[model samples]
Target: MDDLDRKLNDAFPGYVVRKDLVKQVRGNAAVPSYVLEFLLGQNCATDDEEQIKLGIERVKDILAKHYVQRAEAGAIRSDIKQTGFQRVIDKVSVVLNEKRDAYEATFENLGISRVLVDSDTVKNNRRLLVSGVWCIADLSYSANEAKDESPYLLQKLKPIQMSRFDFEGYAEKRGNFTMDEWIDVLIRSIGLDPSQMGKRAKLFQLTRLVTYCERNYNLIELGPKGTGKSHVYSEFSPHGILISGGEVTPAKLFVNNSTGRIGLVGYWDCVAFDEFAGKNKRPKADIVDIMKNYMANKSFSRGIEQVTAEASMVFVGNTSHDIAYMINFSDLFEDLPTVYHDPAFIDRLHAYIPGWEMDIIRGDMFSSDFGFIVDYLAEALRHTRALDYSELYRDHFELSDTLSTRDKDGIQKTFSGLMKIIFPNKEVTTEEIAEILEFCLEMRKRVKDSLYRIDETFSRVQFAYRPVDGGSWVNVETLEEIDFPGTYHARDLVPLEGESVDEAVIEVAEDHSGTTVQEVSAERVSVPAIEEKTLFEGHKAYRENQRGVSFDGLFGDYLKGARRIEIIDPYIRSFHQCRNLMELLEVALRYFDYKAPSLEVHLVTGPDDYDVAKQRDYLDQIANAMAPLGLDFTYEIDMSGIIHARHLKIDDSWDILLDRGLDIFQKFDSGNAFAIENRMPEMRRVRQFEVTYLKKD
Candidate 1:
């Protein structure tokens, strides 16, 4: 085990389990992950290898004997009759047999019905009436002479969920792991490899869980399919339920006037709608109206009574059109049903997860490392819902005064949920608080920004915040604003006095391959550009899918007319990293005289610990290759282990700081001779990173 694995084991102890173990024990049992993990938590929670092997066998044996398969239900029934009683794992739902004036249970996959169940069981597990619950059930069969008497009997029943948890212990142990480690642990617990996701993507995945941990929070995610948008609500927790978009009704979601029985909102912590976006589909107006009220006021009207619920609402859907197409011609809410496209409903949403930023679910993304048993994590979150961390940031920072109460509520709920997930101990640094606060603002701002385009009466507000210690305000902008500037700026119906609307409008033509090419006119709207000094110096940021950025465009102006340059980047050890260094050097040579020996470059980098000799060989190859091109290249290892900054100094005139150095391009098919990105770096899709330029005194 690695350091992280050991720390997680020591901190969480028996509550942690290897995530890959679920697959080993899930053979043909069509059960949610939480159900499998509930069993794993009982048998295989320990870290010992022998114990885990034995637990796997024991679990397999239990499943084989108890788990019901529809194909073999008849054989199981025959076995039950032969044995008189048998325990089986299946979905159990209860209903009131009105004529008999008694409650009865039905095993969904076992193909058994009209089994006698006590009223106490129905009262305890009310969810059985809505979507049913996975339970371990005892069934017995007997021959009966009377036609009215049923032959099946339900001997016992137990829901497959965590019965108990220690919230205080969970909060205390959270101190052992840093925020980043905790985030990675949560990511691994969700069956994802943390190393394969970026910081933004990781936070986005964690944001999906906020609905489970917060009350009445509404969220929406619309993007391409296969991104696992609905996976968490469906499989991660027993306290949440996922229903089809078309399957939802006022009776199932809010309240049934006829029975006076509350619906999903009364039982589940979160109610998520799957495949929610379809322009052609029509939803009941009454359902939409009650949902809007419930989402905003946390209450719905049923007949003469008003009912309230704490369930958070989540909508996940697939967009038929890409982001740019929607931004230019329509809006982000384009794929939602006509009823849901209303501005009031859109404004009620606290956040809009940019699902396009997520990569499609791939096989290698699954983790084999140890993480908290999901049931344990689910219980921890459930307990945290009662605690209020919304005001945690008030002492450190303040939001803009122009934000409405609704906006403030949305931001606070999101921030509070993130704090509970990341820092349950309520301890954080100023920068840490700012990171989460800015993310919260951006999420809320995405919803508001779309509202502006959808409804003209919705005036815009600057989503900025100021630190209590007195510093320049930090303003947040949606990534779509930066990527589609022309479309974003053209949304205003009334142009400024000096600017023409024609100039702001840019036409985008998409080809058969779905590649967008923009055609801009000289006449355009004028908006205040973000101050470069505020962004480039001492401020950290991120950019994604940025194009037209090359070595010349990024650093050529700064490095021009310089005799010497110093490059201090610690990660230039691998072959691809060395190739990145060579490309930078070529860019430098293009600026200076190629035949001049005065232009010198020095690299201070860290050596590859696994193979120092190979690192030296690659650096030497770069030096030899550059010497022939009249550029003097020299490299040295930083033995002090303190050279962490990635920056370049050009003759003491400018300092260029880079978050990812020259290795910004994502992994591509470099071996393919026909690949354009292999030959031209400009053709590559760069990973999300940031670069800053600073001028020396």
Candidate 2:
């Protein structure tokens, strides 16, 4: 156990289990994570591995033994009768018997209904009775009930989530850990390896975490499929309810007019609509209008009565097109069905998470570190909704006057949500505040940027905003625009290194036997020149442009005496950033004589602001990739906390600081290895970047 693991264990001794153990016991239950974690919390919370294994086996046995399966419902009923009392797991729903003035539990799969439940159970666990619940219910025979009616009575039951939590204690305990430690704990507790996720990706994810804290907050995210947009709402919290987009109706979401009963909002803390995108899924316009109004006002009218609910709304969907393509050709809401594309409805959204910025779902992305049992975190967030944390940022900075009242509201809501997730204890600094502010603005800007491309009437206001205290206002545009304008501006290459290596050209040739030529390009060369000519025939012309350059030319002379090279880019932290670093190294290797002089590379880059462990993981991945080549590529995290500039250093004396560094390429097509641009180094698309060489004084 690391610092956090020990802390969590010490604080909640005998009640906290390693989060990953829950997943192991869950197997293929198709149940929510909270449900599995609840069982784990009850049985495997202890730190002993053997005890945990035994507990997991016991839980599995319990589920397999008593859980009602639709395929074997008849067998389960027999067991309940034969055993007299059976503990069964199933989706439990309840209905109020207004005529009898009592509540009855209904087991869906077991085909049992009206199992008399005590009033205390219904009143105390209203959440379980309100929505679907996975529970362990004690069954007993009740002969008084008719044969057609439920004969088995629900004697005792436990809801999956521990309803009661110490919110104040949770908040107080949060003060003990630093922001980084807290982030690590949160990531680990949720069973994720924080080391694998990137800072930007983590920030994007934490934005969603805010829903766990705030009430009536509306957020929407539309991007390519399989990004795990629905995962959090579906499994991260028991308080949240995830519904299929098409399956939900106004009655289920808002209020059921037939019974005058409030809908999901009255019960769930967070309600998410899954699979919300597509051009053909025709959602009722009236429903969208009602949702827009309810999202803004936190109230809805059902029949003659007006009802208010505190549920935060989340919409997740898949986009048919890439972000760049949509931004250039259509609007941000292009994936939204035409009926739901009204600007008024879109404007109701508080933030638009850049779904395109998220990586595709992969197994390696899951974290196994310690985080709050999500149900506990959800309970904490339910209380946090009442506490205002947005003012912390306002104390240091102010928003622009040009931002409309509605726009400011959107920004502040997002800011508040982030504040609650990252600094729930209210312990943060100016720099941290700035990062959250920048993120808030960027999220809102994603909405605005897409709007501009979609509707001609939408004004092309600067997707820009200013901070109060001191610093330049930033445009929420891609980094390519700021650093590699000459190249990304046109979204194409300008051939700055025309024909040869633009300014520092490297040339390679192959002999009849097809071996790499060792002679350097004559247009530009170091202090020394190569004398070989026989190896110069059948040479192919290539250019070292900003985006993706051919590695063959850069490493043609590695067989010489260049043994140690230093990479000094400032942006090698994220997975994509690491990929860029790997590409550069691959190019540098072409010059090495594999049989004789082996090459070694070293990297020094900036530390990630969101999480440091992820930075370390990226470096390790790079090292692993070069291990086979006998290349020793290592990285040391920059401690200066002020290196924003991107650059490169070779050996020790030769410094090649890049204006754009490695993250100069535009997003690739399909992100596949076999893509033409990905396979052909020279053809790979890249943004324009300036490389300047300096010698040691």
Candidate 3:
């Protein structure tokens, strides 16, 4: 077992099983992940593989004989009738029957409705009725005449996850376990193995845990699709409901004014809208307005009375365009329905998860070591809602005065959510607090920047906070500067002229390739034919936001006798990655006019991991396509380990050191290929790449 698996085993003792065994015992049973993990937790939450295998076999046998699916519902009913009592696994949802003076059970898969449930079962399992509680139900049919049906069955239900948690007792016993062990217990409780997750990924998982702890926190995620945004909301919790965007109705979401029936908000702990983005898809204005109000105040108006609910709201959507396009042309929230794009509605959101940063969902991302049952974790979160963790950060630092009330709220909510998820026990350091604070600020800034793009009237505020210890204030925007140089404008590069603050405004440029940058000595240098080469004088055009500028226009007019051009980049494999190389060739092709001058383009790149056969196939196709256009492409993998500089040297002179190299375009979209910019090469979308030219030594 891995350290994480061992830790879970040590933490939960015999109650936490490896995540992989849940699937094994599931066999053909169509159940949620939490249900499978619950069973695994009961019988096989152990490190002993032989015992687990045997336990899994037994569990499978029990499920196969008991679980009710659509095809076997009739058989189950027949078995219950003949045997007078039979155990069956099914999703049980309970509703109050006023006339009968008892709660009735609704079996989703069995197609059974209004089955009379025992009073003890109803009263003892009030929480089970709210969300789908997977249970082993004993059905006994009686030949009694009722208004709705001639025969009725008594459902003696047993929930898989009973309310057995002793929160106070657990709090008392929590001191026995070390901090790392407690973290493992939390991980095991959520049915996940910590070993499989990286530090950043663990933080993300913790962020999702806020839904369990906080009440009515509004979270929105917008990015490219298939990032598993809806997975946790749909599959992790019985207390959470995932509704399709089209299926959500005012009657279903809020209280129904007609019959005075409370909706999902009254019952579910979290309500998530799947596929929530699409500009053309029109939504009800009333829905948006009511949601805005509810998200802000945790209450909605139904007739004259205000009905309050604790259900957190989640919005998951896909963006048709890349981030750069959205940043340059429109706001990030532009993909949202026009009705939801209102500033009031946007302001209510606590955090905006940049779904693009989340890696695409793959098989390996799932944990197999151990995690708590998601339902159990969800219930724990629901209980934690009463606790306020937001104030923990105030003692250490102060928020910037420039930030608005909404901005401050966003930051605090995010900080609280993250704290509740990660540092629930309040065992953390100043460094850890700073890390999470930075993340919270970034999430809030995503919302702020996108909103700024939509409405320029909003003033730019400093997303920084000062520590109380008289040290420097932490700035989130400065972190962006560390991550990307293009994040800062050219005018921001003015060198400071003071000896006192020399180190404070120092410029640190790291060139690991051993190429030293000498200050320009233009006064001593004599130019030969440099004045005659005015090719780039008028054609040179550079944009502030452009990732990489094509040098084709700059040196094309002066490339009459150019021969060999060498380009280097460490990473160049994907189609987009290769397009960076192709762009370089596009620049090189400009130098040749008469018979293309037999121009040779040599590319030194790392070895491709995406199938050699496919690479050859793609290159062959490209060669065939570009052969008629007088462009020759040749590439070699670097095995010598000699070259590390990312520069393009033309004929041993006129070198260009590329900061971001040539992979300048933002993520591509196949759906928007018909757009004019996509069709037009020059007008094609490109990201930031810096190029500085110098004469070769």
Candidate 4:
């Protein structure tokens, strides 16, 4: 086990299970991850290898014997009949059989119906009465020929979820881990490794959980498929239910008009609608009206009575068009059905997650690390919904007065949920609060901006905020707004061939192979020759996975005509970091004269704490490669241990502060030489970063 694994075990023993263990025992079993993790949490929650092995075998044995498969349902029923009684794992849903004056339990996979269930069982497991819940139930069969009675009988029933959790203890122990550690813990808890995601991308995943941790928060995500949009709601928690968007009915989601019974909103902490973005979907008018009321007022009309519930709503679907096309020709909510495209319904949404920023699911992204058995994490998040951390940013920042009450509510709910998940203890720094506040504003602004494009009556309002401590008001813009400025906001409305909406010029190429050409972004084009280009002084932000960006265009003018350059970035120790430095040097080479007497570039960086020898060797390689090119490259271990500032100093005048330094690009197919991203830097996407050009006074 690594340091994090050891720390997790030491901090909260018997609550966490190795994430990879889920796959080992989940062979062809059509069960949610929480159901499997519940079993694993009971058996293999310890670090002992021998105990884990035994527990794995025991769990596998239990599944093999008890878990029901539709294909083997008949054989299992025969076995139950022969044995007279058997315990099986399957989804169990119950409905009150009014005529019989008893609740009837139906085994979803066992394919049995009309089994008697006591009222107390239905009351204790109310969620099962709403949606089918995975449960381990004892069943018995006694061949009967009666018309109203069946031989199949339900004995003891147990819902496969965390029965009890100590929220106080969980919150107290949460203080033991730093913000970064806790974020990574949540990332791992969701089955993805934190090392594979960036700060922005990690937040993107965490935002999906806000619905679980906040009341009445409505969020939607629409992008290309395979980004795990529905995974969290379906697998990570028992408190959330993921149903098909088309499958939902007003009776199922809100209330049954025939029977005075409540639905999913009354039972689950979060109700996520999967495959929600279809242009042709025909949702019922009553459901849409009920949804708008519930999403906005958190209450729906039920036969002259108003019903209220705390369940947050989440909508996940796939987009047919890319971000640029949607932003230019239509709104971000382009994929929604015509009925749901109502401005009133769209305005009720709190946030629109930029799903395009998330990388598609990859094998290496799955974590094998120790994390909460998900059910435990789910309970903790559910408990946090009762607490409000929205005012945490009031001491440091304030929202724009232009924002409506709905806007404020959306922003506050999102901020509060993120705080509960990240800082459950309610302890945070000002910088941390600012980051969350700005992110909240940007998210809400994304939704509001689309409203302007969708509805002419929606007025444009300034989506900006300022620090209460007296800094300049900061303007917020969605990543798409910055990436496609000319075509976005309905400007220019068109792009001619061989030109770009952002600034990365496209080169025209011919298709000589007698086939259709494939168009790809060329972000990493070679550096242009030095010229009298104006070097602007300001800050710019880039989004993760946003293409058409490179060091050549970012700082080619700043590095031009410099006799001496000092790049002070503390984390240039890894192979990728070193390669990033070499690429930056390549950009500077095109700007500087090779025949110049002293083309000096010294990097102030930190040694790799894990492997300093390897770090030095990589640095040496850069020095050797640069020496032959007439650029004297040297690096020194800052040794200060606090070289947090990443910036480049040119001739003691120009200073370019880098938020992510030279390592701004996201991981890609570096080993695959033929990959377009490897051949063209412009084709590669970048991690969210900021760069500021400042002249030293």
Q: Which prediction has the highest TM-score against the true structure?
A: 1
Whole-model lDDT per candidate:
0.84, 0.70, 0.66, 0.86
Which pairs of residues have clashing backbones in candidate 1?
503-523, 503-524, 504-524
Whole-structure CA lDDT of model 4: 0.86
Model 2 agreement with the true structure over 553-639: per-residue lDDT tens digits: 333342234578876666788877887777777766666667755677877788887888988987897898888887888888887
> Which scores higher on TM-score, 3 or 4?
4
lDDT by residue for model 1 (264-343), tens = 89989999999999999899899998988899999999898887889999999999987777776678898999999999
Best prediction by lDDT: 4
TM-score winner, 1 or 4: 1
Q: lDDT tens string, model 4, 472-566?
A: 77878777867765434441233567767545433222222234233323332245578866668888877776788988888888877889999
Count the clashes in each prediction: 3, 20, 16, 6
Question: Global CA lDDT of candidate 2, please?
Answer: 0.70
Q: How should the candidates be ordered by lDDT, best one leading?
A: 4, 1, 2, 3
Which candidate, 1 or 2, would have the higher TM-score against the true structure?
A: 1
True-vs-predicted CA distance for residue 427, candidate 2, Å: 0.8
The regions of model 2 sitting more than 4 angstroms off are 1-4, 11-15, 145-149, 460-475, 478-697
Q: List, residue by residue over 293-387, the lDDT tens digit for candidate 3.
A: 99989999989999899988888899998754554335568788888887778878878876655556656555666665565556666667778
- TM-score for each prediction? 0.88, 0.75, 0.69, 0.88
